[model samples]
Target: MEHPARTLTARLLASRSLPRTDPQVRRALVDEAFRAELEARLAAVGLQLIDNPYAEHVAVALADDVHEPVFGAGREYAASNIGLTRDQIALLVIIWALIVLPKRERQVNRQKLIDDGQHDMFGQEAPLPHGEEVAGSLSEASLLADFAPVLGHKTYVQGKLLSRLAQLGFIERRGGLIFEGPLLDVLLDYRLLADRIIHGTLGEVLAQAGHPLPDSDGADEGL
Candidate 1:
């Protein structure tokens, strides 16, 4: 049996190839049964198929329910925003742990460290002093540790994941530091989506890493 989506897709593509002056094609284009089937198939994936009388084109859009998840509940974030894979989500959670969370902790700990006179052999008490300088990057060793649960201890898989994320504008490596890139900021805008990708998709990996699931509010604050 031909799938409804496939049938609709074929009809739309066929219509595009023919001129509007063709009588049979014009009738098929305006057929109620064809229109209904196309709309029904699109609705199955949370989309709407609409005819534009003013133009010779059809506009397919997200259904009201899909928009509701984005503007109302905040649960369906990733589908609309930044695309993330399971491996990427694992890397993001690790980045959150190494960079975002620690930056906050470092600010609170700075005063205490200074008060306690914590200093290195060179007599420098302040560690980097700047949040981005200190916590915005990670070392390969640290990444390996954090990524082990998801990508495993395999160096090749780790390298591929890192390369893929970097290619996708998620991370950037300079010298020994791995900094969050511009795409991370976009991901942070949809915090609920990021949290869902992390906790919902990577629950076991997160548990193994001893990472706490993030609260919906302010989860993506520092990213």
Candidate 2:
């Protein structure tokens, strides 16, 4: 009989990303033995599971241990494995900060409320908030106005980078709004990126534009 771990691993590679609610994905999340087997299989090829409780999708990435061997052969390892230019990376960070930081805060709050409501000491814990349920869309026009100067002007951002980001599964654009895509939260490290965005110069720019980072003291770490 074919092992389920192999099947699930193949599915993940084929799909690039899958929702946490997917049957195979949910099984991988809850079944520790199964997950370990899956991880072992992935690590054979120098890959690792990219799973985050706060994010909606699960994906795979090159393992950190093998990163130097893989990406450092011919060129100085750049910020991304994909061929993203510096400006594109900057624009991606801006959009991620605008959308994900607030969404995570809401998810944490909702989970807290659920925990408070459950009186049974042994009650099964509620699932983490789904991205679509807590995430807010960014107005493309507003983003263009606020970040055009730094992001290479409105025409360039609108003409090139947004389309590329959308193609790369980082965002989805519809009706003049941008929604988080499958990889937005999966590929990026939230704890690393959030701290930098919330405390760094970008925080000042966002605040000036009336979209300040939400206040939180250690709540971010809880998630």
Candidate 3:
């Protein structure tokens, strides 16, 4: 799973502004030391600390695996948007739908994937092969485009996200495919995979802020 770091959450915590009249509470992001401390505390609670930290947010996999909670508190996410934001979430949901809905996973939900004859974010056709060559300069290629065929998004709204998860370590390249490292190093984990399925850091942030995420659910066909 790929995750992008946001610049704003690094040094200071952004809070909702209020009219003057009271002492302002200093909201500070939990630094590395604090994160380690939280991990230790959670470990005591029988929860294994799966480190999934990002610049603006941090998340861990719960032992039972229902919901993975992100740490950053002040950030806001509106799961819904009129344009690309909604479409991106749809793509993300479709990816997850492939895994969670069991027999229906392969069945693309109509509402989730509205066939408007639009290419995915990468500007490529759908049901992409395990890999593909995007029509653009090498530098113009993004992680989203790389996965379009592998994930099979041919004629749907392209997700607005371009970030790929690589913070854990170095990167590897195999033709048009990008990887964290050698294939042997990969872990079979679905929790992290869901976050990777989600597109757009800002959109996910807004969605987490208790806004509408009407587009989070996507479709394919004959599901």
lDDT, candidates in the order shown? 0.53, 0.86, 0.30
What is the per-residue lDDT of model 2 for residues 132-177, given as tens digits with 9 covering 90 to 100?
6798899999999988887788999988899999998999999999
Score residue 10 of candidate 1 by CA lDDT. 56
TM-score for each predicted model, relative to the true structure: 0.39, 0.92, 0.22
* Candidate 1 residue-wise lDDT, 99-172, digit = tens: 55444444445544554667444434433243243345667666676666556655754576777777765567
* Lowest-sum lDDT 10-residue window in model 3: 17-26
Report the C-alpha displacement of residue 117, candidate 3, in angstroms.
49
Candidate 3, lDDT over the whole model:
0.30
Model 3 Cα lDDT, one tens digit per residue, 74-192: 32433432223554544444333232222122223321242443434533234311111211112114424434554446433232232221222212334654433211012223343
Each prediction's total of clashing residue pairs, residues at least 3 apart in sequence or on different chains, is: 0, 0, 22
Q: 5 in model 3: Cα distance from truth in Å?
A: 24
RMSD in order of candidates: 18.3, 2.1, 19.3
The numbered model that scores best in lDDT is 2
- Please give the ranking of all candidate structures by lDDT, highest first, separated by commas: 2, 1, 3
Checking candidate 2 for backbone clashes, the offending pairs are: none
